[model samples]
Target: MPPHARSRIESDLPGDQAAGKPAPQQPAWPDPGLLDEVQRELLNRPALVPAEESAHLADLMAAVARREAVALQGGDCAELFEDAAPSPVHRKLEQLYDLSATLREQLGMPVVTMGRMAGQYAKPRSSDWEHTPGGEVLAVYRGDAVNAAEADAAARVPDARRLLAAHDCAAATLKVIRESWQGRADGNRVFAAHELLLLPYELPQVRADPEPYASSLHFGWIGDRTREPDGAHVALAASVRNPVGVKVGPSTTAADLVRLARILNPERRPGRLTFIARMGADRIDPLLPPLVEAVSATGIPVAWISDPMHGNTTKTGRGRKTRSVQAILDELTAFVRILRAHGAWPGGLHLEMTPEPVTECVARSADARTAALNQYRSPCDPRLNAEQAADVVDAFVALLRAA
Candidate 1:
């Protein structure tokens, strides 16, 4: 990384004020020298998105916060290196745009669409290692950016070389997004986003045109695992000028949520910050209203969106992780109700979905155990297929019209 960027990160910034300083879920790369070399190489590479485009997305997000627009952000849960080709990228964009179009028509408001592509190559695993069905124990698969998803020991080893491959894949995916985004009559467009995990990959991509901003992707978010108010990840997000979101789970205290809003968006820029609520269907009623009330009382223009996927995850009869489409909708309904009751805008939806017909996610009324086992393909978490995702959009439309 450049000296200026490194200094900015190491030095105390406004976001460095919170208590917990631990940065969890990072890969323990074997070779430190090789990792430094990779960071240097990435520092010399071009940014995936420009600073101006990030500003524009922030503007759109502000509109969402004001209830003048709605946003739809979705894509694969963990992007694979092999799926970086044009066909996969195009299909994903097609799915996202179609959903956004439906939102625009139904709500009579512009929809800002963001795809969890380009830089979504890293993930946060619950455990450092796992046991395979064959009784072989190995390091858990973090993401394509860290190690291979295969169960073999050699494939699970963290390698610095994969960092460069991830950057290349992201750039290629961005190229496809740009090329396909041209000549749209409806004037709809999609932006690139990913979890701002892996500081090794993120810090090097930080560029200072005048002030530092994460130029790796148009939008980056802090996952629930890494959103420590005083930790390195929060510092990284706070250091940048890009529009950022944080996953707000059930355990998040109202005071902490307010503090995070103040820390991440000190200036109270309308669209600069978003709080994505992932409270489970059973938890949203009691947990969310107080959070919304507290944050709203602060008068910060933070967008409130629903991430119904993460908190609703359940294990099937065979013990495979899956999400129920009906449970997701249930959470969405409660999310909208809580936000509206607190006088907060139900600004958008954040989802994990794919164009592929993966049966990893099934409707609640279906033979869930049997249905979730067929054609399951995600390397990490279950994602809604095209039809299942459309069902979500239809439900959101109903919620809005009734509102």
Candidate 2:
């Protein structure tokens, strides 16, 4: 429990403490039927093969090497390889290997197959949230301003309804991409809900749209091991950057973010909303109080996702086995404790990762001990090799368990 969290929870209880009875027993774990249903649904949906399905995945390394060689050598062999597009077999095999890299790295083993989860996209007429058997299903809205404007314009023109619908469909698809998770069951599985990341973009009209064209809401009902519906939860977070010497826009302010949260979570009364704060290192200090105030204004819970792997201010030394590695870990631990002291620990975390082990974002160090730091070009960066991605996931799991 972090600061103010215990108090917040206590405040929510009725004053009749003396008359209160023991809390109800937790729900029984769900049955296997639910898990089976989920598996069937996921397998039936159209999915992309990111990695090779065959046991001989090592063969891809050779093929990639061959392709690289052809690219490097500017001779008849190179020209022939370039002129003749890679065979379908080769292309498919390459994709299979590429995608599998991260999955294998994070899981600490090889992945035989992967599939996409089917999500239920819908719009609620009223503010009433639906209850899935497990708990609450996550519902995210696609509410980018550009899409909102297009939807508004289409509303006045009857003929433009189709165009609006197209935009809505596109928005819905983006929502799915942002929030859906690829599940791996064998090890400590990673279950992600992406809606929280899209909260800033949710628009009012789109949320109310009966058949919204540009702005829409999408949700997926996820079940735990017992195959029962898991309830829905909300996390409010943002990427931060230094603005001390830069001009700040209205949209960049914490006030703007709070306003956005209010608009997106209409069902949450001012005093009942709950949120978790995930601050990036660059803007952590200045952003902290404002975030607390904004969410607290709505009486929501706010926790922090102390992502040391990405958010830590420490830079890697010349080598991975450098003496600073221990120091960096110690600093990250202290940072987590600091956040916990500020009533921001919610026992949850968010990580940007992948399923491959190649040096797609940064070259691997020649020495195993030399640390390789990634220079991300943008927020939605896919930079991790499979092994690094797995390391991040494992780190997160370890952190959670330790907390």
Scanning candidate 2 in windows of ten residues, the lowest lDDT window is 69-78
Tens digits of per-residue lDDT for model 2, 1-403: 1011010111111121211221111111123344233324323332221111111222211222222100000001001111122242233223333444444554344232211111111111111122333563322111221112122333212121222333343334333332323352322221112231111122211211122211221211111111111111111111110000011111235664455445333443221222223344344556555555555566433222333323332323432111122222333354445544555443322233333342323322222244454333221222343355344434543543465
Evaluate model 2: give its TM-score. Answer: 0.33
The candidate that achieves the highest lDDT relative to the unseen native structure: 1
What does candidate 1's lDDT look like per residue over 1-403, in tens digits? 1011121223222223222345666788778689888988888898888998898889888898888898899999999999999999999999998999899988998998999999899999887778898888788888999999988999988888999999999999999988877896323779999999887888888888778888899889998888878777887888889999999998899998998999899998998999999999989999998899899889888998999999999887777789988899999999998888778889889999999988888789355666646788999999999999999999999998898
Q: Give the winner by TM-score.
A: 1
Model 1 pairs in collision: none
What is residue 277's positional error in candidate 2, in angstroms? Answer: 5.4
| lDDT for 216 (candidate 2) | 23
Structural similarity to truth (TM-score) of each candidate:
0.94, 0.33
